[model samples]
Target: MDIFELDSAFVLHTYARRKIAFERGENATLFDQNGDDYIDFASGIGVNSVGHGNGRLAAAIADQASKIIHSSNLYTIAIQARLAERVVRLSGLDARVFFANSGAEANEGAIKLARKYGQNSGRFEIITLRNSFHGRTIATLKATGQEKFHARFGPFPDGFVYAADTEDVLRKIGGRTAAAMVELVQGEGGVLPLDEEAVRNLAAELKKRDILLIADEVQTGVFRSGEFTASIGYSIEPDIFTLAKGLGGGVPIGAVVTTKKELFEYGDHASTFGGNFLSARAAYTVLEILEEIKNSGKLARTIGYFARKNGEISAKYPRLFLGEAGVGLMRALIAKDDLIQQAVLERAHKERVLVLRSGGSRVRMLPPLTISKEEIDLGFQRLDSACRAADF
Candidate 1:
């Protein structure tokens, strides 16, 4: 079957997907069905962390697949246990973890745990920030603060509210308040990052009130933001955090990490594919490479190079861009307006530089952690060429 045609015919029309059908990818570049090159600044929306065609990761997946692709979670999986342990160890956050299949599921698991934590206390509310996205499942959709995601979806589950500021969050805290969840850098909320000082202050208040804090790290986790998680960079230790996207390196996996080990009982939550051998092995491979990158100074070097190049892009195109909109490899060039943003996206696509349109007039880039300084420079140069060719 023709891949693109079959997808158009059979797949749900949920996404305004790009036209090109990507055939394969290498380190930081993707090749389309036409065999044209597109430097993958988007990184499959921050999922391909170590990048495409990673030999070790591929070999590990092949090796594991031959052994056993999956098994009942009823049986303790060694790979799952190891991945969870590795995540907690590297994060340096004393926490226990539960695995799931996607960020939405992870967020759902987090909400369930927080609610269960407050079940005895009679507090079950979860207040997320305005414009923050948690996930798209029913409960997670309710957890999301954007009205755009909530239209026609109501009579949503109660005990969910959105805070527009620190004061609003404080005001919302009451007898029923259970937790406040945030995305340190709001990915879909236009790639806008929350102020660290404000976040720290708010977290302190939550702690004072004995309320849990949940950091939705689906998009910003896995060294995309220069830390294992952006919450670490923020210097705020949350009660719970959700992980997905890059965790499985391309395989699907979601994890909910919590400080409270005794929050859930045996019957509280479960998943069929959660923590299965296939995804866990893939994620373990990603962690191995990321640890190497973090230790060998490549992670820092790549982030610094990206920041410097982005600074140059802004300096050269002051008229086209307003500023930068995020941190680390998960960043965006803030276009002056929607038209400018569209122009940058289209023109850059013409130059074979793949990027994404994020919330808040931003053109986002989520390059692989494995990307080199040379590839970063090449992406920016191609973007610049696109702009120049557009005579802007």
Candidate 2:
């Protein structure tokens, strides 16, 4: 049976799957069943940080798999301990780590930790910014600032308040507020970065009130945002930060790093598959590659190349693209309208290029960090062709 027929017959219809089927991938390029190459600008929605078909990444997973897959959380896992140390060092916090399976789980764990930290004071409220996107769980859906995602998922967990700005956060941060979480750059919210001044001010204010600040760096962590962490750029020292997406470099893993580790006693929280040996190995290797590229200065060069190519695309098609906004490779190109946006996406696919429609008029690009400058140029040229052929 064909892929479509097989999926339609058995699989659940969660996502609107495209017609094309990719057979394999190498670095920033994917080959379809027809042996056509498509320059991947989506990178599996920012999960393939080390790139596809990476030898080291594959080898690490394979080597760990041959040894062990899951031993549950009942026993100590050395790789998980090593990965926790790695995360703490990178976070620059006197912190402890908790591993989950996805960004949503990470945020959920963080919420629990923050509430536990303030439970003695009857403070369980978490204030998130409007237009921010968290995970999709019952608690996280309520934590998400956008009301659109909250429509059908009613009767959500309580104590999540959506704020407009720092001033609102301050006003809402009475005795009931335990923490305020933010996505340094709201990836699903059209890749909008928070205002620098506002983030810094909120950090300071939260610190003064002993209210925790969590940075949801699921899309911006592991050097995906050009910096090691987006909070560093905003000068906001977050009390806790969550990592996922690129953390496993295509494998599934999630982590919540917090400075206050004593909030929870023994057996307070645990995940059956969290920080298993295989996933921990993969995550460690991804972090190792990120460190090497960052130290050698290649990461910065590649990010600059991406920004430059973004400019070239907007310049070449002034009406098609209305500039872009993001840090590093996580950018969204704002189009004229929904018609032009959808048309360009369809045309880009026709031109053997992959991009994602983030919002109604925002085309998101989250290419692999290992993508070369030459690959950026080629992707832009193909994107230009797509834009030229696109018709509203």
Candidate 3:
């Protein structure tokens, strides 16, 4: 049997698998088994920060693996320690770090930390924004705001609430509220970004009530949002921040960082493969590349160029395009409806550019940060072709 038949036979049908099966990738592009090239605007759903097959990242992983890979967290690992220090230093927050395997696990860790911090105070509730996407784990699923993901997955743990307005969030923060979790850019929610002023004001209010603010930077961190963290650009100093997706380039790694070390005590939480040497080396290399990009000012220039091109696309096709919103590489093009959005994505795929959908009517674009001007232009041309070919 071929790859598709093999997948259909054995794999669980959780995702609506795309037609093309990618065999290999190079910076900003993926190649299928047939050797057809597709410009990767999705960037593995915002995980490949430095792009595919980065030599430095590969060398780091190989070098670390040749020496040692998994030295359980029980002992002090040198690379892990160095990564923790780098994260704390670059975060501009006095915090401790706990590593995990994915975004869901990081959010799960953050939830546990919040619940423990508020256990004595009788505050166990977590308030998340309406339409926000957290994760797939039981705890993180409960923390998510959308009901579609909750189908048949119950009985969900209590103390989770959804709020749309700031006043509503404030009202929900009564005695039972432990923390308020937010995504600076709600990537899955149509790539929506919260207003800077609103986030700052909300953080201040949560501070007064002693409610921990958890920023889910799973999709928006690591220079995907122009800054190291979107919270930094928004000026919202969250008490706890969860990171994953792009932290280890293509490697699986997640982290929960907190300003308060007292929130987590011994035996409260741990992960076996969290900060293993291999993943730590990948993450460390990614951070180094990010620092170089920032220092060279290429990140800022690329972000500006992308935003301008998105604006041009929206302006050129006002009848079908609603608008665009988001920060840095985490952007979306709003279609007139879900049908139009689907049509555009399908056409774009045929045009050899890989994009993704956000919410119902948003075409999400999360291209690699290291993408070049020529690649960006090519992606834009393909997207334009898609827009023209789409029926609606």
Top-TM-score structure, candidate number = 3
List residue ranges in candidate 3 displaced over 4 A. none
The residue-by-residue lDDT of candidate 1 on 1-392, one tens digit each, is 67878899999999988789888988898899899988989899899999999999999999999999888789989999999999899778899999999999999999998899888999999988898888888899989898989998778889898899656888888899999998999998888888889999999999999999999999999888988999999999999999999999999999999998888889899999998999999999999999899888889989888888877887688888888767988888888888888888899999999889888888889999999777888899998987676545
Instruction: For candidate 2, list the clashing residue pairs, or say none.
Output: none
TM-score of each: 0.97, 0.97, 0.98
Residues 4-94, candidate 2: write the lDDT tens digits.
8998889898889987888889889999989999999999999999888999999999999999999998999999999999888887778
Q: Global lDDT for candidate 2?
A: 0.88
RMSD of each: 1.3, 1.2, 1.0
Model 1 CA lDDT for position 361: 84
In angstroms, give how far residue 39 of model 2 lies from its true place: 0.7
> What is the Cα root-mean-square deviation between model 3 and the actual structure?
1.0
Overall lDDT per candidate, in order of appearance:
0.90, 0.88, 0.91
Model 2 RMSD to the real structure? 1.2
Model 1 lDDT-worst window of ten: 383-392
Rank ordering of all candidates by lDDT, starting from the highest: 3, 1, 2
In model 3, pairs of residues that clash are none
